[model samples]
Target: MTGNGADRKTALVISAHAADFVWRCGGAIALHQARGYEVTVACLSFGERGESAKLWKQEGMTLEAVKSARRNEAEAAAKALDVHDIRFFDLGDYPLEMDRDAKFRLVDLIRAVQPNFMFSHSRFDPYNTDHMYATQIALETRMIAQAWGHNPSEKVLGAPQLYLFEPHQTEQMGWRPDVFLDISEVWDKKRAAIECMQGQEHLWTYYTNVAENRGNHFRRNSGGMAGGRPARYAEGFETVFPRTVDELG
Candidate 1:
């Protein structure tokens, strides 16, 4: 298929679980969408096997029931973020493994979107290997999509900036964020999105606190007591690719 207009900017986010995007980078998604970028979110799994505790606590909840409930919550969360295209691979989690075909499918999506930038989990996560594995797959798929001989008919992908969003436990995950985004303007939308994940309601306040802390970091880095814009909420990211630019702003 052909690519979109050159003026149109796009982005893709690969989440290990259905609700990972909301917690990790919902603010970035909302902020970019507001900036007129077409953002596509691809959730690798529903996290039914492990991530959904509230649903599992309920009586008589089958595997399918849990998956359905998680899917509903993720869809609601995506909607709250104004995300129009959100896909669930449903490959399973707690040990999320993707076969060759699944990798190819991801490659196709990457090539099709031709995103200017992308977001994925941290490279290392001991607590949840699924998160790191998803990033591994994302890197592999991105490489495959860039290969000219992989699929001659499809348009090859460009070298887009791959930004790793913050992990749950940054110290353990060794996730040092270099980019701090002030999402104060879109904090309300991100908060609404965070609330939509009913399965992980306990994390709502925790993530809110994270945003607030990151906001403080943003202010400190931008201009520590030197008249920087006061921010109420923020998100952080570590870029995997070196950003090329004519001038550093």
Candidate 2:
């Protein structure tokens, strides 16, 4: 981490599906953009295969409809965060298995951008195969990005620090948030970002709850409400870097 807050930071946020980013890390993206960081969003799938309840049975909710709506939503959300680049791999939804080809494609993306930080779902999520698989792909892609022999397209950019975003179902694997980012200044932007996923408004209430919950954590730890946007709200992550205390201390 740089001491100067004005440093140009870059971040890549990967998710199993389109709406996942809105639910998981929309606020974080907004926060990054507010700090002048370049942000990239990559979705493994459009989430056409996920459970839709009665919404899918509605008049015009075909699989294509869902995918198109998600694309538009992601676009609006990215714009709210000042993110210029958004990539969709169009992998199969619900169960996003990182086949050999898919893995290589993701690795190529990482090599191309070389973000300073990478955020994705946790591999410990057991209920969602797509989420778990997306994390697996991210993990493998991180390794491949640094490998000298593989991925000829990439010029061996050093590995970015990987962080696991808090999952929707946090109790399952238990989210241990080591880092809490105060995104109070961008909460409205974040809310608008989440509202971009109109197809999942009903499903996104869980995320609002999450933001409020994480906000309380931020307040408790930081000692007061801060930032330029709202009184509270944050995106939390667990750093996967294995380092000695000396490196941090």
Candidate 3:
């Protein structure tokens, strides 16, 4: 948000599973990194319990093995996206439950990062409760981080816009995207990052198609059929907080 560009800006992404961020907003992460934002991705769980079907299909895959593989894949994906500050909550998935202490830990991270904006799952997802649960924690932690009485010494959080990335089934989840990001320049980076999630290799091409479709949406919204910027890949987001502007651009 700084115009001078001397100070470093930050953005936080809260992913329910290890591979969620890669599939949902890898382009956004890469694009923001190019824009000089220090993007931090926090995976709430390894998704071993529910999401790692490929790994589980193996003859004798243990929970520890699944967790290790997921962590490694997530680290590699983050690296591909130029994200250096990735954290694994290791909270366990299927039903990601965060206790009071866990919530406080997340709040501490929010205070430390003080991101300009945040990204998480849609508000509601019937197929995946873990995804919705992560967003709930995101909302709670953001509120706690902004509380004056939560911790007197720690820095309080500012009003950072929480953007819900597109869900797997947007229509069913009631996720309406109001903002479209032109990530055509970073599509290669995103595709590379998507490849890092080896456990979910099937999703690689699926998300590529998603980016292509979102690009069409971007062109349509930004002045379609006339003179819209030619974007080949894009990402969509639904803002949770009201954006304040000097004037309507």
Candidate 4:
């Protein structure tokens, strides 16, 4: 708030579950926060139903216990990146369908935050129905935010940039990321940030591998990996609403 105005340019990361952003766009979030960007993390659910039993067995983790544990973990991770706003929607764990009211709430949040950039999982993720539903929520929220007369209040809230974070889809999902943000400098912070997910049992490693692979892909595109490299370690994103056709075309 002191260094840079939080209201100016904000980033909102909306994930289906507690650890989705940690496993995918942790580095990107850290990088944005380091650059004085206001960051908000919104978890649709605490993933209570999916948390590793082998890890939380010692805590006698129930649904409430798991949700509390995940909240603390998410707070720690967001704090590591200097994120100010961390919210959880608590819309159940596995099934994240958008009942009309839920979509309106999401639209209201988009209108209130007015994030310049948004990060969410792809709609094509087949492994998790929640991810696809979350993506749907993001898309519908974007539409609602921009719909004039329809949402009288949101008419003032202009359309914000939206980016779909990479899903855990290597072969079947067919996700092609069109935007990549260099996060090499924040990689360590990203690793440190994700370690806070105690319920995850070192889930950072999977993302680290993804980052490394993306880094190599970055190198291949830029002709180098480090030292004045064009975005070595990064997170890849696809635009849900394509505003610019110059490059995309």
Candidate 5:
């Protein structure tokens, strides 16, 4: 509600699974939230089927139980990141799909938030089609939101940059980074959020390593030998649209 205010800056993240946002762009979410931006996360699924291997191994695990556990973890992580809002589509995973009605719901949300910019998964992911499908949903919904005839009464959505977060296997996913965000200040918050994903304990150290590596990249790109922002942690992104700038510097 507050994010819709004309003066407020807002961002939307379309996560394919419960922990995708946590593992991918938690730093960006935390940093931007700290900088007075209301960040909203839309999780397409709890990753109950494919991604809940740890939970499934626990002796007694049902679909509903897994979903509950995953949702709780997601909420905890969102709280750690100070997320303004979090929505769950509960559309199922392993092959996330959305019909016309579901898509319209997302388009409505996009209209309500009217985010300054949006975040989603890389365009292509061979390992996980769900990740790529979520990005497709984001793009389609964004376009639908801009259509004047879709919802004639509501305000037409403005063009917002869709930033694709770094995927797990960059080498195989063909994801290239065109932007690096310095999240040194909110690294602690992002780490705290990452810890909330108790289901995926194995990834705790891996994503931490990712931030550290990206921080090095940030330092190098910021000024290489000349001296850059001494960023201790960072996140990488690939913009789907061109950025309009008044000056190069």
Candidate 6:
């Protein structure tokens, strides 16, 4: 929306934890990168205390050690997906509180990326308050990015779609995804990225099944038993904001 040509096609993923993007929207990231779009992932935390239970079971594991391990895995996963950039805020999880400065920092990233669309966690996650908190931060930063008075020297952000990606235990989270992306083309890349989350090996299979089930939904929604795209793997997302179009389907 900011410019023309391939360089203008950009996307931002605001993840609550190091591996959230990998599990939720890894295929979208890889597929977008494959289609000449630069996708940047921003992780607020390394999920050291809350999401790194396996690593904590180690004999002599420390907080820094767990954080380092998660960071390494995220970097490798980003590499596998050919991500344009991956940033770690090191904001420590469990509560995942953000001060005014932290929110401003994210606003800066939003303006810099100037993404055509953005991805973040679900709005409500009782199981993981950190996930919902990340979504709140995503919405706040996006609004700040669009304000002219926030940083008059830089270009204000345009209206980019903020997509709320699906969450674990989604049934209880009230996350209804209206968008289904076919990631069959990049399923291998997604799987490779999923495998990189060595600390959270338990979730790897669960997410794989999620992709497969979402693929079925994609096919059915597109037109099942008639003329549907054969998507073997997919990801679902719920849109946070509405769009303004000249025409509607």
Best by lDDT: 6
Off by over 4 Å in 1: 1-5
Candidate 6 lDDT score at position 32:
94
- The clash count of every prediction, one per candidate, is 0, 1, 0, 0, 0, 0
Tell me the TM-score of model 1.
0.97
Q: Whose TM-score is higher: candidate 1's or candidate 4's?
A: 1
Where does model 6 exceed 4 Å of error?
1-6
lDDT tens digits, residues 95-192, model 3? 89999999999998888888988999999999999999999999999999989999988878888889999999888999999999999999989999
RMSD of 4: 3.8
Cα error of candidate 3 at position 196, Å? 0.9
Candidate 5's residue-wise lDDT over 140-246, tens digit each?
Answer: 99999999999899988888999999999999888999999999899889999999998999999999999999999999999988988888899999999887777
> What's model 5's lDDT at 27?
92
TM-scores of the models, in the order given: 0.97, 0.88, 0.97, 0.87, 0.97, 0.97
Q: 2 or 3: which has the higher lDDT?
A: 3
- Tell me how far the alpha carbon of residue 89 in candidate 2 is from the true structure, in angstroms, after superposition: 0.4
lDDT of 1: 0.93
lDDT agreement with native, every candidate: 0.93, 0.77, 0.91, 0.75, 0.93, 0.93
Q: After superposition, how far is residue 39 of candidate 1 from its true place, in Å?
A: 0.6
Tens digit of lDDT per residue, candidate 2, span 1-61?
3111345467888888877777778877877777777788898888876844444868867
Which residues of candidate 4, in runs, are more than 4 Å off? 1-7, 55-59, 224-232, 245-249
Clash pairs detected, candidate 5 = none
Among all windows of 10 consecutive residues in model 4, the one with the lowest summed lDDT is 1-10
**Candidate 1 positional error at 31, Å:** 0.6
- lDDT string, candidate 4, 69-175, tens digits: 78888888888767768888888766676688877777777777777778888768678878878878887777777778657844345556677788876566767
